[model samples]
Target: MKSSMHNPHLAPEKYGIMDGISECIVTTISSKGPNAAPMGIIKNSNGIKIRVFKGSKTYGNIMNFPFLAANVVYDPKIYTMTTFSNLERSQFDTIVYEDVEFPVLKDGISWMLFECNNLQKSSQSLVADLIPVKAKLSHIDAVRAPNRGFNSVLEACIHATRYQLTGSQKYLDLMQYHAEIIRKCGGKTEKEALDQLYRFMKTNK
Candidate 1:
């Protein structure tokens, strides 16, 4: 069976419903060491728009330094570890890729530059401002595999934020994932925020 996205590189014979949306683990560095977060990139009339949350580290970094790499690689661990506090990996080391900056533990790929001109927020699908920038994809690792267990939970944080931000219709699309994490991992303000997100998503919806 030939995939609609015909690339000999992709493992499975049939690539299902991921027709256009490309998911990338966005790596950014601020005064705070590293932020390896998962983000969705969509093609627009002008170029690519990186959809991220306003309160996320990625958002903060971009605000400080507008330059960032939309790292397109093959690691679900990046997403899982980005949001989860339980991954036992080596500490991040500062590595430079661009003349500007580089992230730790990168998989090397070439010719994968997708210009990000649009910066969409997790709050509104179409309201975020689109910033123009030129970036180079220096490396590419293996093709990305499916996320599961804790990885799946971390992936849901993106969803959780959307539910957290909206003035209306928040819960129906976002509350379910955050609730799961809170029930499983109880703690301080995180638990409060998750519960608050749930309440907000509910009443606002």
Candidate 2:
């Protein structure tokens, strides 16, 4: 599907996103209202694919409604909240398309509305084929440059989540390595995010 909004910065190919995982906050509306989660999006020539596990609120909502929004954000709090807890309704705003509900993160840099065409379900998860319907670039300038500190924080967050799930010492070691990088090379925001991750790990451990 073609997007109505034109965003030069949405050129995934230029950012080397042709085939890799791009982290984003995915929001969907359920009967209970809106829910958000951190998701790693797989982008390729075919389209964007999202793997939503069965029994998850995201999977259930998309299965019922077949529409969701993917919001690109750089906020560490957004990542932590969505991954560890549900977001409050006030944290997001809504955009209505053809009466279809789309939840947009207030702090997101960009957002894309996706309509699920096919759902291939496996024993572990449901892979949804997403067709982009609407997209907007809110902070084009922000994403124009590369920041190692920010990237490290995102990578560390992924490892931290994995460690939480599996309690693997390997992931914990990796998380600590990334934390060191954040301490040495990260900026204020990166350091702040690292602190949050450390606090979470201490409590969770």
Please state every model's RMSD to the true fold in angstroms.
Answer: 10.3, 3.9
Report the Cα lDDT for residue 104, model 1: 40
What 10-residue stretch in candidate 1 is worst by lDDT? 10-19
Question: Candidate 2's residue-wise lDDT over 117-146, tens digit each?
Answer: 678989989998776666677776774366
Give the TM-score (vs. native) of candidate 2. 0.84
TM-scores for every candidate against the unseen true structure: 0.47, 0.84
Tens-digit lDDT track for model 1 on 78-166?
44345433222353334443354545434523212222333444553322332323333443234544433334344455565454556
Q: After superposition, how far is residue 26 of candidate 1 from its true place, in Å?
A: 0.4
| C-alpha-based local distance difference test score of model 1 | 0.45
